[model samples]
Target: MDETENGNLSSDYIAWTIVANVLAKQMNMAGPSAAYNGQAPLSEAQMKRIHDYFFGRLHGGFQIAELAATLGMSRTSFFKRFGRTARVTPNQYLQILRVEKAKILLRNENLTLIEIAFACGYADQSHLARFFKRYVRMSPGRYRSKMREEDVA
Candidate 1:
């Protein structure tokens, strides 16, 4: 492998190691249960409004409090209501959406990571890589390479 590839391999290893260690410690600490407790179901109108808000503004800054206010609810209520209805936190949902868009853009092979990151509402390539790895379990560069290889095959 070339020097750049070697460096990236080591970097990836170190990053993932740090993440694993941190996650293990956090997992042991007492935290809110991930289970869905009984709550009032989101109304169809509420569901539609949220869906429209998210899909329409994937490239905009996402603030949970702002979204909660827009939905006419308090932050705490929005958190519980959204989690119960969407099966994920707002941050998680946003990352997944951005990463999914990035995946599509990666397939083009013409767009740089920076371009994709901006288009996907990330601050920079590093920010995009961080969330992409968290949600997709791989770097954007590696994912793009794999997809290209699969297309060729």
Candidate 2:
């Protein structure tokens, strides 16, 4: 291979190797010694616990206060820690999660907007429409219509 081609191949191999290492570490398939040692160390176990707690339970009627208590932290402290770890406030994160689920329901077309709203944890269709507009920049109905048009195209 030419010098440029050889360099590109080497770079691609290095990138793939790093990705594989990270995946292995995340799955805990690699031995303890294979874990990443990086700057600004925090407990990976603690972070994993937090991630599971937030994502797994939050959608099923788990309240913020209860989450904070589960983490053995005051509500304020928990909010700060959750924000620091997640890079968004807890409520913002929950809203995003709920909205994403709502988008899936919108795609189904069989569910009424009110049903989808309730399924995704909103109080009603109006509440869903408000937050959906804020993040998605369109009403759910309009968004679904656009998706249908795109599918036909």
Candidate 3:
């Protein structure tokens, strides 16, 4: 009922929506033959480890080569395996992850653009603005304003 409560509920909804959509996409890709391929599919543990490593690098700053080493894989082999499992190149996946984090931060409206940029692993607000425009089709300020307007309505 209060503003804070409403904001928390909206944030929860947004997070759940993102997770649901991702799960739906994965579910749609599941197939009998896809599981029975000659090469063993990644175990759930392996998938979780890979996902955690990738997500951590995006959410928390970590060098790509270091992450690869932590996974006990060479950079080339790690990238190849990650791409095969995630269906996107490592760089592309990182970009998407960063953009998604930026979207969540945009909704907060308390943090300055520069703060959000660095929090999302961008070099600066300008860097974030460029990628935000490329991926979201609008500047971060505009995106936040629009979302607030929609919330008001």
Which candidate ranks first by TM-score, i.e. highest?
A: 1
lDDT against the true structure, each candidate: 0.84, 0.73, 0.78
By TM-score rank, best first, the candidates go: 1, 3, 2
Instruction: Spell out the clash pairs found in candidate 2.
Output: none
Backbone atom clashes (below 3 Å) for every candidate: 0, 0, 0
lDDT of 3 by residue, 45-152 (tens): 766876677677875555668867776656666666666677787677778789889999999978999999999899999999998999899999999999999999
- Per-residue C-alpha lDDT of model 1 across residues 1-153, encoded as one tens digit per residue: 234744777777788999999998897685544432325656789878877778778878667888778877777888888887888888788778889999999999889999999999988999999999998999999999999999999
Runs in model 2 with CA error above 4 Å?
1-62
Q: Where does model 1 exceed 4 Å of error?
A: 1-38, 43-45, 63-66, 69-72
- Candidate with better lDDT, 1 vs 2: 1
Native-referenced Cα lDDT, model 3: 0.78
Model 1, CA-based lDDT? 0.84
Per-residue lDDT for 48-116 in model 2, tens only?
765566567434656778876775656666666566567777677777778888888888878899999
Query: Which candidate number has the best lDDT?
Result: 1
The local lDDT score (0 to 100) that residue 33 gets in candidate 1 is: 44
